[model samples]
Target: MASDAGVPDPETQSLDADELAFSDEGIEATLSPADPESDIAAIFDALFLISRLAQHNFPARIDIHTFAYLACLMSIYSGQPANEWGYSFSAVPPTLPYSPTLDGAIDRLVETDYLKTSKSTDVTNLAEFELTPEGERELGFFSTLSLLSRRLQFLDASTSAAVFTSSAAVVNSLANEPQLAAATHLNSSRQLLTESSTARLYDEFEALSQAIGKTDVNLILPASMYVSYLQSVMRATAEEATGEAVENA
Candidate 1:
């Protein structure tokens, strides 16, 4: 039950889709793109899409300090390209805003196995960090979680309040409007921050609403849709908890 359409390797790395479908019984449903055309199928499809995007966009690993400072660099160099990433970090030239010093981060990365030390004899600060094979694998997983945390921060910046949809039924209804659903994720994403400084695990989520409207829209929107499913489940659970409290009172 797998599609050969651009699947990444299946090794010690099983960083597959994290969006899961639950039936009325709270059991995860097996998904198929070929099932009957209901909201259920659409929801599963969206989950699958987001998971793929997360896996694909996942980046190399770095410690908490560098992660905290990465937002500045990402926005600063959104469209820019660098032939050498290690030098790129060194070039940021950390300042007194209490930023994670890129130079320091590069050194830590070298000490840890995350980055390999390949000397650049010609240039002064041009250290080469070919992310270790282990780093490559960890990067794939941790990058996804990092991406979501950054998205949450971006969303917080734009909105003073949390947008909580209050029902699973609402989520089911929105699943069909994929574009609109993805739009809900725009506040967060693109910067790749995380809560835990030592975060190295992927969130069991695949879709990202944060990057849904862009040209890479096709790949990310489906993943973004999973947010809808999560929102609905959360809303319903909260409502039930409230109702139970009232009954107890």
Candidate 2:
């Protein structure tokens, strides 16, 4: 079945299995950067690769659309804006259509064993998911791609807003919690993520230990959380520190 754009719409082609006209040789499609339909394929090559790796390694049924959706969620989960994910029903940044997209994407992933979902009955009606061992294994295969894709996709001014808005909201919510702020400020003013003046290094264990300081309850935070908080706080502190240093000078 030929689509309006002259491509065989997969849906239509699937409907009439007997009339399917494409063979491996006939299935030559390319990403056209100029075409709206193809723009996504071009931009999301890396994200698609992440999902593709999972599908290849595990039994994940990751279609292009499913991959894009999961990558979008991961972007959000990783602190990038929805725009960087480049997904919107109406075509705009952070403009999500509804929960169906997320639900379906998660369902597809979970059913295929590419992801695992668990409920925190320790809390009231609370549930969250983490990547399964299979998911993590697949992620490791494309770890660099996943990392780079998340960063590259949000390499725009909009990322600052997406990150900052949530950052500020979180900081304020914990405003009364001075221990965290104290740890935050101390960690930030030192800029500990990097090594000293001449060395390059990171201490994952120390960072993760600090992050899990309050694990009596049911919760977990990624080690990256501390780095993000420290970095953001340091950015603000740097502005003030520079102004003060200049005044002193």
Candidate 3:
């Protein structure tokens, strides 16, 4: 069920802590604190989260691209705060990537039976899409993957919490050993760069991993290599047939 806020009602929401049981331990500390700087990020997170849930749950079909586009347009029309759309929308016309532009991707999705288009309720508007049975099966797989990802995130948060616990323990231990207090820099110089470097590296690694995963390796992998692999299998089959013919003779 949807709320007046235009997002799903939390009570009716399917993907919740009770339904999925993603690890909750030590994640409380890692939860992001809301502030003005994070407004745009929060908007996107909300938009995508609701979009995925809507696609998976709602009877009426909506693709992510269409939903995002319309939502942005409507938000502007309804006088949503400037900060919500500012940083990303400054450009007059944004560049969409090659091969699978929004239109192209939607077309391909429909062609592959992942989605099906139907006439809109209002004739003035364009058609909307709904998931096919195949699409729902794919969505089930996606949900499974999302559950695993949440578990991993929770595990990571728990490890970070453990580190904080260990650090506190060390600080307490140092308090007992007054001699070591002078040796430690905990109260004095802060090495911000060293502390933040690991986090930056992790962010880079995650970004690279995501980029690599999204890449169409079929476009990059040599066609000749695939041909050679198939040819070797065919050659082995031909040799086996020859041996069988000779035995029969």
Candidate 4:
């Protein structure tokens, strides 16, 4: 039941007859293993957190190119070669051409304000880039472990009915698209699903949950969709509440 990391494997755990697990003390066991995609996202989040936590350790400037190239830097920092990380540049979109250098990608990142050249550094010819303050703050949102865990617990709670409604919304939206709903072949469905980010995310999460031994599709799909719904609701509520509080001042 234990993984090489010595942690109990989520897939090996038994659920209660009622469809969820709880400790004898009535505490819920909500641990879940992130899928490969989620794991990569978490890695980026953690890297951003680590960089900010030890801001002084980083040079006044850092470098970033494309996502794949940046991922290579992250791998190197983790004492790995880029090839060992198994990154695919084509994963982004239209197939990327092989370039001996990443100068083009680096230029784009610099123009986008995600990375900025260091003002204090005196190296004239060398182009160094660093995470702009805005970039750090954006990545930092995903870096909050407490928030992520809290959201996971909410998804696994018995009272989580919101996710079902969210999943239904996804299904309803897809059904309303006559072109997609009428597709008889798998390729058509795949293309339509891939075109919509929401549809794609739900599909991926549902697959992950099922692969990890979730027997009830009804439960898993809803839970997967609910996470996205909760994020939107939480963000909107926070903005509204903060605005009202400011107006009343």
Candidate 5:
């Protein structure tokens, strides 16, 4: 059930508290907020804006899990030093990391009518949500802010607008992220993707940026290439696995 304006439903309120505790403990452990001008501070602000942007631009109704996962991906692609973003995710088997901060943001948005719950047909029975008309209006207001406008414009210029708007492409890219493969290899149920874990990804983007040269390059250009690389990797992996299965059969 959806909540009234300014009041979240009971389930949402409970989720909000739990998510807040998890985010505060997990993120604060990795990112110190003592320095206002630090990269960590910038990453946090970008994370906030990116999550809202993901919500606003998603082409269809999204479940909390999917929304959170996509927001994480968008944060990485937003050109911030990924290592400075202190988002920690616990590996949920057969899915991407469960991000407490992003999840909580969804609840908060629901409370403010920026998002609303929808019926779920999937077996997981998780409540799905869609951005409210008010949410679009709110994003319009945010677009007036220079920081967000720059980020949005960077994305628009760098990547095909269709990519970010497509749910399948977003999920496929995340599933194929090299970091996810590393986490799977660790064989841990509670694998935490820490800041250090993102160092390689950050480095990869940095390298791509340098190769492209700074004068006319947008951060999203490197980001789009990174995502495409991962997608191709997934396709190749799937083919390899299928062939091996055929041989065994």
Candidate 6:
């Protein structure tokens, strides 16, 4: 007795299943639309911090890389967790991890004339940048945004002399971050820096903040502690590395 006409043979059934699995329509149907909200937030965060830093360092242009480094510090000081923050960086030695998100943010700002390029160079990161008058206006507008009020307050706190004497010191501290050091060590093997790598640092910062108690003036205290912790960790890591090298030698 022959099978029903509508029934597919085993070979035909396999071919049909393969086609459904590999077809462009099938693949596209399984994928979700990209949500750009996170990326947009990241751009806004970068813009706010970069503009504030630029204003802080007015009349003195900084390289793109420095802007990114300082922005990272500002974000941490603003109480953002490492994973929840808007930017990601790769471990780069002698400096803070290089952030492609920040690099793109700078590019967008320059293109929009919110930031001015003082010295154009083949390497965009090496070129000097400062906030434009329009950028200042933009920052003013940002201050009015309800979403940014807390961040603006954090920035204000961080810039006050009570927190740190200079943004330059904050920039320099990036070089000594133990997490960055670990990432740099792994970078040679092409490993990406994971957010978990900085979890301990963030946890410590939170613990310190809780211990300090919350108050208007205390907004900046945690940031100071975070920097101090980074310095201590950096020294310990360097000493350990050096001792190992000596023993091996």
lDDT of each: 0.29, 0.33, 0.30, 0.33, 0.46, 0.49
- The worst-scoring run of ten residues by lDDT in candidate 3 lies at 90-99
Winner on TM-score between 1 and 6 is 6
lDDT of model number 3: 0.30
Cand. 6 Cα-lDDT: 0.49
TM-score of 6: 0.61
lDDT of 3 by residue, 110-162 (tens): 67877665554563114555666776665555444332222222122222221
Greater-TM-score candidate between 3 and 5: 5
Where model 5 places Cα greater than 4 Å from the true spot, the runs are 1-79, 83-90, 118-126, 145-165, 185-195, 210-216
Cα lDDT tens digits for candidate 4, 77-139: 222222222222211112111121233334444576655665545562244445777667655
In terms of lDDT, the best-performing candidate is 6
Residue-level lDDT tens digits of model 5 in 1-249: 111222111222221111211111223344333332232223323333434444445322222344344344444444333333444556554565555554555556768787665554553235555556876676667556543343453334323422554545655566665566666666555634454455555555445445555513443555566666677878898899999999999
lDDT of 3 at 83: 25
Q: Which scores greater on lDDT, model 2 or model 3? A: 2
Q: What root-mean-square deviation over C-alphas does model 3 reach?
A: 25.4
Kindly indicate the candidate among 2 and 5 with the higher lDDT: 5
TM-score of 3: 0.24
Cα lDDT tens digits, model 1, 128-206, are 3455666556545544543222232312211111123222232233322222223333432121211221121112221
Tell me each candidate's TM-score. 0.24, 0.27, 0.24, 0.24, 0.59, 0.61
Instruction: Write the residue-wise lDDT of candidate 2 on 1-249 in tens digits.
Output: 112343222222221212222112110122222444333322333233334333323212222222333233223333233333322311111111122233344555557676653443454113344566776665555435432333333222222222333423322322212222443444432211111210111132233334455322211133124335545655676698899999999
